[model samples]
Target: MKRLIPLFALCIGLPAAAQTPQLILESLVAKAGPASAARGEQLYRAKSKAGKTADSCAACHTDNPKAVGQHVKTFKAIDPLAPVAQKDRFTDPAKVEKWFKRNCQEVLDRPCTPQEKADFTAYMISVK
Candidate 1:
């Protein structure tokens, strides 16, 4: 019975922890309604008004999300954002929300709306 408890717990938790990119995007759309890939692309490339220096998702991610990127400040190598290039790009809902929270604050001076997040996810998924 003790061994069964742990195994059962793991089984129950597995599906919640493991999610597909489409699943995550669908959840976001549930909150924000339909997402527009074109709007997402525009937002990703738009310059920020958050600071004097130009800061946009494209500053680090580049115009092509399918290509690997380098952080402009840290110079850390970032994997491609497109799910087509990186199958794990948006697989984890927690990580997806984490990056959106951090990056939106950095680039937009505010956390992104559910609509914005859904749009971004749609755009990244569209890249092949």
Candidate 2:
């Protein structure tokens, strides 16, 4: 149990073991074309009003991606998504996809496309 707990801690903070966020974003851009921060911001702030937990990404993430957020239902503190605010926010591709999967379903009631992911990430980097 002791060994498992320590392993879990390292797994939780495995950002250094993952690809840099820029590389993943570039891959996304290659598939999705040039990303637009404006479009990303629009998507980010748009309310779906379909999910039970929240209306849009902004409902929990805040209008400003650089600001810390709270989970709509759990009230758990979420670290800022902006790269500038939190250096390791999107460094892990697996973690990024995991959250995108969960959050998109919760807010958009569907899976996000490569374009949306690219734009959203670009917007995160653009924040200052």
lDDT to native, each model: 0.83, 0.81
lDDT of 2 by residue, 1-128 (tens): 63243245356875346665676677567668888888888889998977778999999988888899998889999898888998988778778889999989988889999999989888887788
Off by over 4 Å in 2: 1-17
Off by over 4 Å in 1: 1-16, 51-54
Error of 2 at 124 (Å): 0.4
Which pairs clash in the backbone of model 2?
none
lDDT of 2 at 90: 75
Best TM-score among the predictions, by candidate number: 1
lDDT of 1: 0.83
Candidate 1 per-residue C-alpha lDDT over 1-128 given as tens digits, one digit per residue, 9 for 90 to 100: 63243245346775347667777777788679799999999989999889333399988888899898988878989999999998888888779988998899888989999999999999998887
Scored by lDDT, the top model is 1
- For every model in order, what is the number of clashing pairs? 0, 0
